[model samples]
Target: MVFSSESFLFLFLPVFMAVYYATPQRWRSYPILLGSYVFYAWWRIDFLGLLVLTTLFAYLMGQRVAAHRGSRQGRIYLTIGIGGCLLVLGVFKYLNFFVDSFAALWGTDAAGLGVHWRLILPIGISFYVFQAMSYLIDVHRGDARANARLIDFAAFIALFPQLIAGPILRYKDLEHQFEHRRHSAELFCDGMARFLVGLAKKVILADAIAPLVDLTFGASDPGFVVAWVGALAYMLQLYFDFSGYSDMAIGLGKMMGFRFGENFRFPYVSRSITEFWRRWHISLSSWLRDYLYVSLGGNRKGAARTYVNLLIVMLLGGLWHGANWTFVIWGLWHGGLLALERVTGWHQRAASYWLALPLTLMLVLLGWVMFRAEAVSDSLAIYAGMLGLNGFINDPLLFGAMSRESIALAGLAALVAAAEPKLWLIFSNAENKGPSGAVVSTRFPAASAPRAHASAALAHQNDGWTVTLATLVLGAYAVFRLTEQSFSPFLYFQF
Candidate 1:
């Protein structure tokens, strides 16, 4: 169930938290495992089996890797583990795309070839599978030790907060917390506030603006005016939607005395695509960099090889989002820009903040068009509309139907996005320091993007009551918005 849904908010959360706190400190994972399983099973019982099997397989493989560390056996086990997990992901996520592409080559579809069955991808397969793979990789790399206790390892993988969508928790980052988590009223409250703020962002901003974005993108030819408005509107919608989900997941982890690291870090403010990837989906970017990019020799090779590495990493990263050409192209777009910036030294120029900011934003918005579209043709049409290849108001009904409420909310969402850095600084005067403030250190330097540790920062900034009071006001309003609206699944959940 989605966090914003009434059933989850009113039923699952309240009941789960009570049971969680009632359990003993050392045995808390029992309740966590039970509740998390129930939560995952809420969607489908059959899917729960895959999750369980994946957890068991990863845990066992990790143990084997750990046992054979630094040997040929260790490398084989690691490859087996990674390959097995990717096999599951590929079958469920990309099998259909491959089948269709093959059929097209033969001038026939899957049905024509008598391949009638279609696979249903389990929700969060991409995320949990990656987590499992990362566990084995880390174990083999000696970055993290394999946990002998299956329960804790199970709990780590199936942790419901990030089970469906994630900040992509790493065993290395969160392992110590599992061994000994500090539970207190203050941390829980900070988490709750962060959850509320994310809820507000999703409901009041993202969801509110979604109808207009749909109307625009759904148009036959939205034209210049509608296209730009829709693109900008969608840009904000996606940011709030995905980032809001990350905040909630992180906050929920914090509530449970586990802190998921930052996933987003105010990417819109970035002056270059290099900086943008560093901030946008910080978890995934860092993961690709550490595991795939570095594995492919990173920048250690010559400049030409480095540029090729960038393209290949991003191309795969884009495909990781979906089995769509649009996503592949989106990855290439950013990858190309990153390579260009590296060659020209534009990323480090520091002389063009005024010019860079808008240029970067426009570039990002263009990439996002591809990201949001269903097909390459759809994205190309949208680009044509934005370029006025189709005149303004070609699809009059779509443009005319856009409500003022959505427009206003779109504007408000942009305002909120702009004010994010300031918002974190609002309640306090102190420069924050350390993990107690909720940001964690990672192996990569770029992993240390300035986090939107809003609730954590705010709670620490204030004299207690103010944080509570402010959160209450925001939470109540966000709840009102939630209950009044139809269910809107988080955008990232599809990934």
Candidate 2:
């Protein structure tokens, strides 16, 4: 079930949490694991077999890797085992795409050369595949211990909070938690507030702009102004959709005493493509960095080889995102920029905030044409329209083009979210900083108190009555929006 669905929010979550907390301490894991399977099976009952098989295979492989530590044969066995998991993912996810592409290029139907069975890709196959692969590799590398308990290993892969979509938990990071986790009132409350904020973002801001994006970009005769606005709307929709989902996953993990890492970090604010990558989809970046890049010799190689390695890694990373050529092009676009930055020392070169930020955002926006379009030609058409090739004055009366209220509200929301006024900053920052606050205070004593004090002062800047009234208004707004919209599946789901 989708996290945003009424059935999930009003039914499944309540029942699950109630049983989860009420279960005996010794038996709590079973209830949580069972609840997770129920959630996964909501999408596809057949997929559960893949989940179990992969979990069992990874666990056995981990034991073998740990047992034969320091043996070449053991290392090779681990490689083959990990390769087996990837082969399953490749066959189910990409086999059809490969066949179709080959057939198109050769002017022959490649499907005729293969089995007739069309595999339905199990939801979250990409996520679990990477998670399992990471666990086995870490065991071989001596970074993590083999998980002997099959249930614990299965729970690691099937953990509901991050199961459907993920922040991509590393085995080493969560190994301790599987052995020991304590639920507390503070953590639950913190998690509730975080999940609520993300829910609000997705239901309120992103959902509100989605119709405009659909109307404009989905239009066949769209003009330049309409195209730009549509692109902007989609960019926002994508962020709040994916990042909002990540926030919910992380928040739910906290409530269960499983800490998944942050997956997004205000990537929209980055002034360079390289910086943007660092901030965007952080978990995937780290996963690729640690596993693939490091395995490929990382920066240990000379500059030229390092560039080649980066290219190879990114191309694979891009392919991992989807079975489409557009995603590959999107990955190559960023990879090419990164390579150029390294060679020309442009990474160190800084432009003014005004120039650099907008330019970088434009580059990203143009790239999204490739990402969001149905085909390469569609992407090119959108680019041409966005460049005013179809004329810029098409939408003379903006209010007439879209309803006056919609344009105003979308513009205001964009400004507020993008500028991130003090109140919004304080709310999101303080909410997420619960456990990390002590570390922050200890490391930056001089800045910590003032920051909190400034936030408090801003809270009181408006009269208490006015502030309370605004909160009520926004809360009402969120509730109204939630009631009107259905769940918007995160864009990352296609991966």
Using lDDT as the measure, the top candidate is 1
- Cα lDDT listed for each candidate: 0.86, 0.77
TM-score of 2: 0.88
TM-score of each: 0.93, 0.88
List clashing residue pairs in candidate 2: none
- After TM-score superposition, the amount by which residue 468's alpha carbon in candidate 2 deviates from its true location, in angstroms, is 11
lDDT of 1 by residue, 118-221 (tens): 99989999889989988898888889988547898899899999888887888888788888989888678778877887888888899999998898788777
Q: What would the per-residue lDDT of candidate 2 be over residues 302-392, giving only the tens digit for each residue? A: 9998888888888888888878898889888878877877897766673444677787888888877788877777777667768888677
What is the number of backbone collisions in each predicted candidate, taken in the order shown? 0, 0
Point to the candidate with the largest TM-score: 1
lDDT of 2 at 4: 76
- Position 262, candidate 2: lDDT: 73
User: Which runs in model 1 stand beyond 4 Å of their true positions?
Assistant: 427-467
